[model samples]
Target: MKIDVHGHLSAPESLYAYKANLLAHRGAHGRGSAGVTDDTLRAALTEPNRTFGNQSHLRHLDEAGVDIQLISPRPYQMMHSEQAKLVEWFAEETNDAIARTCRIEPGRFRGIAGMPQSMETTPERWTKELRRCVTDLGFVGAMLNPDPYEGAAQPPALSDRFWYPVWEAVCELDVPVLIHSAGCRPPARESYSLHFIQEETLAVAAMLSSSVLDDFPTLKIIVSHGGGAIPYQRGRFQPGALRAGITFEERMRKLYYDTCLYTRDSIELLLRAVGTDRCLFGTEKPGTGSTRDPRTGRWVDDIHLLIEDIDWLDDGQRKQLFETNARELFRI
Candidate 1:
């Protein structure tokens, strides 16, 4: 069974309506409901107008040769820089909607929660939502935004003691934390897509340089979008300017990577850098990769085909990349 580790919910318009109301009232609405129902979900997913979605999320999964997908809230739209209460309310509702969607199709989908992170709040404070999603909502894992304040200000690095609360909790809970960044609001920031790359590159560099993993040995992290230019530009981190204490590649292997890179060449580089055992299939389908690659007729998010095209990969590597790695990390 091929399990895609990276996916975002194709939520109903009604669920997003809650965001509109919350923003309109500036959280004075007292945490509005998503108003999501199965029928609304069906219409939103299967309908022709998805903003960036296909006719159906399930159909995209099938077309991409994915059996199951672990889905989280759309990271770009999460609005992590909003006020704590407003962010938390929206996050709670999004997780609830994801749970609701997974329940509708237990075999095809699983929930990966989005934490309500805001500027100036302790990371541990949001652990309650992480715990709720895992224990109460029966989620498999969660997406941790290392920079919740976006690009407005410098937040604590992932290796800092400031994040100890979250690290300690994930270690005990035994769930993998996806190292992804939320929206970027810096006046001179690059496009949102490029922002994901910048944050992930910084996260990998910082985590490797510090002893975060040594402090919590059991903690698992999956760096999305193929480690965000780190693997490709390995020479920049070759133990000269930045010291990871250990060899850069060895430290990199300690963390996991996802196959969300848009090109086959980049995915190959990541697999070579981190090895297949430390890699998992992650398409991020219906996100930026929803569009078709002109050279190939299939959508860019059809990562299974991309991996299949890599001639050097053996069957064992293919098996690990497509299924084994995700199964072990998620414990499914």
Candidate 2:
């Protein structure tokens, strides 16, 4: 069972709904409309039967040797800056779309809900929605934007006490939270790849420096995008933690990482840093762009092939990375 833990849905109905709501009350929302136009978004959304978990997506998954995918809304669609009511509505709609997709083939798709993370949203509010997704909707997990303020206002750090309630909720529910960054507020932070890396790196560092993990000891956080440069910067963090009487590596062990790094060397580095038990297979397929691999003459977003190419990992370790870890973490 090769489970890809990172995948995204671009639901047109939800997007159009949010766009209409955002446009109707222009002054109420903080962030302006950006990115792909409605036509393009709709065109992308209308792809065959599978938006993320449909037949087309499953065909690709079969080609990549992926048995299942934990699907969530695209990060850009996680409109964290809209009014709380609208944000909640959008989240429900998005999660419903994901549920719909998963319904197409339960064996091939599982759901990860989107949260309503506006500035006005309280942890109690998050807990409510999370419970709805998990208990009623049959979702396995959720995506949380630690910085929900987006372009509207400065947001609290992931370590802030403001997020404690949400952390407690996740611990109580026994569901992992995929700590994904959303919405590029500042123009300088507009590049999706660059912003994702920056925010994920910062989120990890903040969690390390704070007591949130210690407080909710069983809480699971799977950082996306190969932990966003965290593995490469171990020299900076590990040594500093040693000086501060802390074991950085031990702290990082509590969290999980996905294989979305796009290269053999980067995945190997992550494997060495976190070990097989803490890493899961993730292609970000159909969402992440592809390029040709000169060696194989095949397009390269198929991360399963990349994992297979790693010469050092034996069959057992490969199983752990590709399937066992996800099954245990998401309880699928």
Candidate 3:
């Protein structure tokens, strides 16, 4: 029962419309185009659906030994820079596409909804859309952007009161939120992977340092990208937690991480620092950087083999990391 909890979906029509809107707006502002060129973006957006239900994705799953994938909209499709209304509409279209793909092979896929996290989006709207995704669309969870204020505007941090309403809704709904970053805005943080890592790590640190977990103890968050350097920098944060009279391990235990670190040593470090129970199997497959490993001749995104190669994990622990943890976290 292997499950990949971190996978992305790109609905071509929805994405193309969003890109068109962005380009038009940017041109008006004399900012030209934003992000990828038209041709590249369209190709990447359509590639996932080309073999969505035609056994191509299934064949990749079979070869990679993944039994199920919890598909969410591609990070870029969140469109946090757009107006809140457009963002919500884009989310609906993206989720509909995901539901359609899941219907093609019900047992092979589940859905994680995308949220309209633009600065103007209200908590009521967020809750309504979340309920729609869960009760109506049968989605298991959602992706949350810690900061959605694009460009020069800095939004309130996740620990501030601005996010309390969403936190309340999450606890009431009993669904986990995968903390994911979308689109880099800062000049120094232009690289996608680097910016994502920085944002996710800083968000987690801020959450830990503040009273967010204490305020909503039942809230579940899965920090993507192997907890984003948190495991490696435990020493830097431990002293602060100790001085603040908080249990560092207890706070960390409440959160979960996914296996997208892309290397054997990094995965081992995550397993050691975060433990097996808190780590969920995830692979952002069929996206960028999924090249064949020269040594193994397997796609680098095939992370199941990476876990299998770890010598210390017994069968029970491996089972927990590969399947049980995700099942419990996402309620799948």
Candidate 4:
């Protein structure tokens, strides 16, 4: 039952241009070549040499020795369309695409639907999409970025009351909210390059400090990129919170984190901080060595090292980290 909980899928071929255009636009503005435009993604789509296009990503997962991979559209795309009229449609299409992939091999894959945060600006919109993602699409959960709005400089949407609507919905769905890193506001921007993990670190801090977890006691959250430095800085957050007359260590204890860092030391530190029960396996894939199977454009291989590296873990801890914990959190 070894499982890698964090995995990503490319935009279906029809959506490549939309992504490429975004990257080209950002590149023009000095955002760096990190952004890949639709053309580039499309070329990957059409390239005969490449295997991870759209259809065969799962085969790669098998090669990686992963028994299960939780798949989702890019987290950034959770906010793909800002226009109110397009939010529902965007959510529908995204979930539909995810559902299609999951159907290919029901037990081996699970989908995490992307819900637009902006649409959640209103309570009703949040309710609708959350229901669709959970009930209609059969997705296990939703993926959220650290920031509420894409390209904005602020903490997580958790600080805003508008997001409460979605928070409530998540609790009702009994699904884990997967929070990944994104951009940050000023002062924080400087760390973006040096500590690329900062965005998600700050977001987890905000969630613990804010009253979200307190408000929804049953809500579960999984942080990406090895909990983005939070486990390493757990003590730092509590002392500061106490000094400010706000203590949240107890609530912070409820959070679940992933092991996406590539090194053994990094994984050991997080395991020590959070303990094996609160940790899960993740590879960030594609960015690592996850390419696609030749015929199917889907992910062929995923974050497999997490399991191979488990000889250092206690037998019980290893089982919880790779399989049991994720099953309890995701109900898969």
Superposed Cα RMSD, model 4: 7.4
Instruction: State the number of backbone clashes in model 2.
Output: 1
The number of the candidate with the highest TM-score is 1
lDDT for residue 188 in candidate 3, whole number 0-100:
44
Which segments of candidate 3 are over 4 A away from where they belong?
Answer: 21-56, 186-188, 244-247
Q: Which runs in model 1 stand beyond 4 Å of their true positions?
A: 241-246
Q: Clashing residue pairs in candidate 2, if any?
A: 50-54
Model 2 Cα lDDT, one tens digit per residue, 93-159: 6777677667656787888988888777687887788899899889999898766866456677889
| Candidate 4: stretches off by over 4 Å | 18-56, 78-82, 86-88, 119-123, 153-160, 182-196, 241-251, 288-303
Output the better candidate (1/3) by TM-score: 1
Which order, best to worst by TM-score? 1, 2, 3, 4
lDDT of 2: 0.78
The digit string of per-residue lDDT tens for model 1 on 1-332 reads 79999998888877777888888899765875888998877665566545444446777887788899999999987989887888988999899888988888889889998988876577788889999999998999989888887888888888789888888878877889998888888684487788889999999988987888898889899999988989988877776634535667787898999999888888888988889999999998877878777787778778889899999999998999999999999999
TM-score, every prediction: 0.96, 0.87, 0.86, 0.75
| Positional deviation of residue 86's Cα in model 4 after best superposition, in angstroms | 4.4
Candidate 2 TM-score, C-alpha based: 0.87
Regarding TM-score, does 2 or 4 come out ahead? 2
* Per-structure clash totals for the candidates: 0, 1, 0, 16
The per-residue C-alpha lDDT of model 1 at residue 40 equals 79
